[model samples]
Target: MATKPKSPHQEQPKTAPPADEGRFRDDTDVAVDAIHQRIVGREQTEPEEGFEPPPVWVWAASVVLLFVMGFYLGRYSGSWSTVAHEVESPAAAAAGPVKRTVNGTVVFTGVCQTCHQADGNGVAGQYPPLAGSEWVTRDAATPIRIVLYGLEGPITVKQTAFNNKMTPFHDKLTDDEIAAVVTHIRSSWRNSASAVTAEEVADLRAKYGVRGSWSAAELSAERSAR
Candidate 1:
């Protein structure tokens, strides 16, 4: 059937029904209350989605990578060597035990240097000077005895008199420790003298048997006349 066309002046009858006020109202333009306003910008999206698990190819690649890494680490790790991470170092493997050496400088710095001073010139008037002192270079036995038993009462060092009491290290220090320290003090600070042997110190220590500390004169019992 032939239908007449509508004139442009006649507005088309509402094709879409007037937008429903409830459904089509602009929610963004709505004035939210204070309580809801806090969550206005932070609104939780509905039906939150999750990421997919890795594909089979990704799993396969990871397995291959881990296997290769494991093989590489097993070969190059050097876990079988004597020390950790000691690789193909032939010099390290062929090396023999090193001769144990005690640094006498270390011993002197730790113990005697406190009183004797780093320069071996002991505190004047308070402690006797070991540097170029007549008592230090007199003999091996004199120093060994002095250190083992300790010295007490007026002793002249470098022509200066010191009357302090030195604490005995006989009970505390080992034979090697005493020997190292004695040898160190003898040679240090230009105070040149023969090294005191540990064997000599041990002999004297065995003979002494917990006697009173030595007086400057009593050191002469074993001290070589110098």
Candidate 2:
């Protein structure tokens, strides 16, 4: 005989309840609701403490601190002195009186200092020894041609050979400037030639207006021959 159909209760397999699923769902929903309430409450609350604004003095202090920092930074960066010097006018600047005699010395230092050192002893191979130079000792006119027309290529000074060239000063220097510089150079070294007068320089410049630098062949101990 067919066995009797199992009862629905017997047919259904016994299953254990899902552990913590319903409770977890309930707890999660509660926590979410609480968070939403907190958010809404925060939105409803008045803006907190009205941002206790800093005092006017504090703002002023901050501005002062920024200015001070910028000033010191500029000073340390070396831009301050440059900017300040640029901003100040030449007349307003702190300085001393410039000596007229120093002008000659300064010109010599700038132009002749390279060949003839500060002491006026020239380099052996590159430049002729200015000290005790016979050419410099000869006359004012000889040095004038040397300055105005310049010297070039294999010059013999006091039996010493100097092959280097000396640049012309006609265009670069004024007549007075040439006079002053030549006078200074001659007197400073072991040379004892008299000061080169501007009249002499002017005469030479007028005489040799467009001439190139003189070579040793072109130069002579006799100024009139040059």
| Candidate lDDT (C-alpha), each | 0.76, 0.74
Error of 2 at 70 (Å): 40
Q: Best candidate per lDDT, number?
A: 1
Candidate 2, residues 1-226, lDDT tens digits: the string is 2354333222222233477665544788667665655554313323333334578999999999999998889877765355553344686555645435436788888898898788776887778877888877677788788888788788788788889878888888988788898888788756777887788999988987788888766666345564
Q: How well does candidate 1 score on lDDT at residue 182?
A: 90
Best candidate, TM-score-wise?
A: 1
Q: What lDDT would candidate 1 get against the real structure?
A: 0.76
**Model 2: residues with Cα > 4 Å off, grouped in runs:** 1-102, 221-226
